[model samples]
Target: MKTMESIENEEAAPRAEHQTETPLESLASIASVLAVGLFVMTFVFQNFEIPSASMVKTLLIGDHVLVDRISLAPPAKWAPFTFYRDIHRGDVIVFLKPGEPDLFLVKRAIGIPGDHIHLRNGVVYLNGVAQKEPYAAMPTSDGDPQHEYNPYRDDFPSIPPDPMYQVTASWQYELPQHIENGDLVVPPGKIFAMGDNRPDSLDGRYWGFVPRENIVGRPMFVYWSFETPADQIEKQSISERLAFMGHILVHIVDQTRWKRTFHLIR
Candidate 1:
């Protein structure tokens, strides 16, 4: 006859064996997790970083943001609940660079398709009304009267097209076609975007309208922020990039902007 403890152990052993997942079940579980992850990445969200000071004061350089891909999805007649909402004025968005499709950029939507957009001394006038932008970052003082004045930056539509100030050869010719009266009339399928740091940003004013298809998503929040040099992330060699990564690891604690972590991006 077996002891009571031995008898209990024998019974528990078979139960444990029965509870073990089969290989097929294990594979299915892994597949389910992967599928969910893929779906989220493809349709729900994506990671983005503030690579430049174009959106300064609103979003700082080194701020890592999560773009909500779901919000920018194309509308579907059958799936009203799942379709993307319309892009609105003052909405900050991440999009593919109009001139360079490979590059991504972030800017505030100042005008939607069909809206009249213009600027007077860097103050944006949308639909003939001056839209108040509390998020915009302005310079403390106007510097240097002799610094080659860019009429396109200060006063929009008032200045004729200049090859030197235009973003691209095509834009130089196409910009005039969109001007109606004194405002730039956004085409039927494009939106006008601009950076909050108006004086420093190279944006739609230089390039052209942002195509609806070029828009990726709206930034939801800053997941992480590390105070870094403005030009540290610009195009660099592989060795330089590796050096930067190592530097980040060493000084993460010192450089991390703790207050900005999990900060909701407007």
Candidate 2:
């Protein structure tokens, strides 16, 4: 017969083996789940980065954003997609170029189809009425000079509130007037979009309305963020060099927005 000590030792051996295997199995399961999640995010939910200061105060440059592709039903007709199931006024979005199919862009959807949009004096008007721009933290300063008045003309009129930021053709009064100067109207099956950074952004004022079909998806959140170089990411010898040069490629690999990393896009 086996001694009590011997039997106890035998039982302990299996217990130790099982304990070791459980952790390994759990780790494997975790890795598998993580891989699946990444796949889903790539196919269903896409990510983007803010390239310009166009949508400043609202969306800063270097911000990492998430775009939702699942919401956009596949293409249907020449116009494309299930049309629009439902798109709100304030929802920020990502999309392809209605004019240049090769381009991708992000901007806040301001006016929808059938809305008469333009700058009256210095304010934004929709359908002959002014839109209540709560999001417009900053407004034109003074003068009939507020918005970009004439395309043929260099400066129409504008008065920046801050004396330091005064008005002139060379000054900040210059809004990105899409193709022509002054105000533009949105057409059917298209919407007008503008960036928060009025003076610096090249938006509807330059390219015109974005076609409904070009809309890729709504931005749900800012999943990840990084501070990368303008030259873009290339293989570097060190992390410091990468941070400066080889760094994160927001437009196209890695950047150091350590503070922004994993930070929620709001």
Candidate that scores best on TM-score: 1
Candidate 2 lDDT, 1-266, residue by residue in tens: 99999999999999998777577788999999999999778756777877666666666566778777756645546545434465567667687855468878877787786565566433566555776765443344445353334322112112221224332232233233221323444557777777765555556555556778788887776556555433342324586665544223443443444565554433
Model 2 residue 62 CA deviation (Å) reads 2.0
The CA root-mean-square deviation of candidate 2, after full C-alpha superposition on the true structure, stands at 9.6
Whole-model lDDT values for every prediction = 0.84, 0.59
Candidate 1 residues lying further than 4 Å off, grouped into runs, are 1-10, 22-28, 76-83, 139-149
Q: Each candidate: RMSD to true structure?
A: 2.7, 9.6
Q: Model 2, poorest ten-residue lDDT window?
A: 152-161
User: How many clashing pairs does model 2 include?
Assistant: 15
TM-score of each: 0.89, 0.59
lDDT of 2: 0.59
